[model samples]
Target: MTQPNLPLLKWAALFEGSSLLALIFIAMPLKYMAAISTVVKIIGPIHGFLFLSFVAIILFYLLTRKLPATTTLIGLVSAFIPFGSFVFKAKYLQ
Candidate 1:
């Protein structure tokens, strides 16, 4: 299998970071401070899609790059926890 391109992985990481920031800083705050249900209603689906995309791209990277099984398992497991992608980025991506 071919190695995962670093550029694509970097882009995916950046996208995930920005989406996470939006969800945490903008959307969640809006829900609480402004009492706006739509904030969550809108951001929830957007965040979900981005999260799924991140996982899909990460899996693809693992397959193509032939990353270690333990690393892949870590990445998959991290997806379930809040702020877990940040941990994955810090530990694995860098």
Candidate 2:
């Protein structure tokens, strides 16, 4: 059986990436700098879930779609940086 490619790949990719950015840039900063842990308490779990989902999607694309190594690498790497997913989509996910 073949799994269909993720139809909303770009949207999911952007969302996952954005969530991570929000956690790192917005939530973490708010938690540490302002003595407010509420943001991390809320956003941390959400970001973790999104990150896992994103990686799962990337793995699906890699195993099922047989994406090129370079493309797969970009997709995997993009999850680490704040704006990397957008760049990855613009360059490779097209």
Candidate 3:
């Protein structure tokens, strides 16, 4: 069987982490403080997509046994924490 693409997973982690940061730090503030609901409308779905994609890729790695349980667990759990994905990537992927 072929191996999973670690580089792609790393990139997914980055994109997912950045999107979360943007949503929380930028979009949410703009929505609440500036009454610009459109920012949340735009960023929410993008973040959701990236989050799902990142989780899916991590699950793929887990199922294929490409990564250990602890690493995969970190990858999955990190999705909920701000900048967690970046930390996971730096710790594991690098």
**TM-score per model over all chains:** 0.74, 0.76, 0.88
**Tens-digit lDDT string for candidate 3 (1-94):** 2234499789999999999889999999999999999999999999999999999999998898888788888889998788999988888887
Lowest lDDT block of 10, candidate 2: 1-10
**The best candidate in terms of lDDT:** 3
lDDT of 2 by residue, 2-85 (tens): 223445667778888788789989998998899999999999899888877887878777887667666777778887777787
TM-score of candidate 3 to 2 decimals = 0.88
- RMSD to true structure for each model, in Å: 3.5, 4.5, 3.5
Which regions of candidate 3 deviate over 4 angstroms?
A: 1-5
Report clash pairs, candidate 3: none
Flag regions of model 1 displaced more than 4 Å.
Answer: 1-5
Candidate 1 local lDDT, 1-94, one digit each (tens):
2333355555665666677788889988998999987987887887788788878877886787656667777877877677777777666766
Q: Rank the candidates by lDDT, best first.
A: 3, 2, 1
The lDDT for every candidate, in the order shown, is 0.73, 0.76, 0.88
Question: Residue 8 CA error for candidate 1 (Å)?
Answer: 2.6
Error of 2 at 65 (Å): 2.1
Instruction: Point out where model 2 deviates above 4 Å.
Output: 1-6
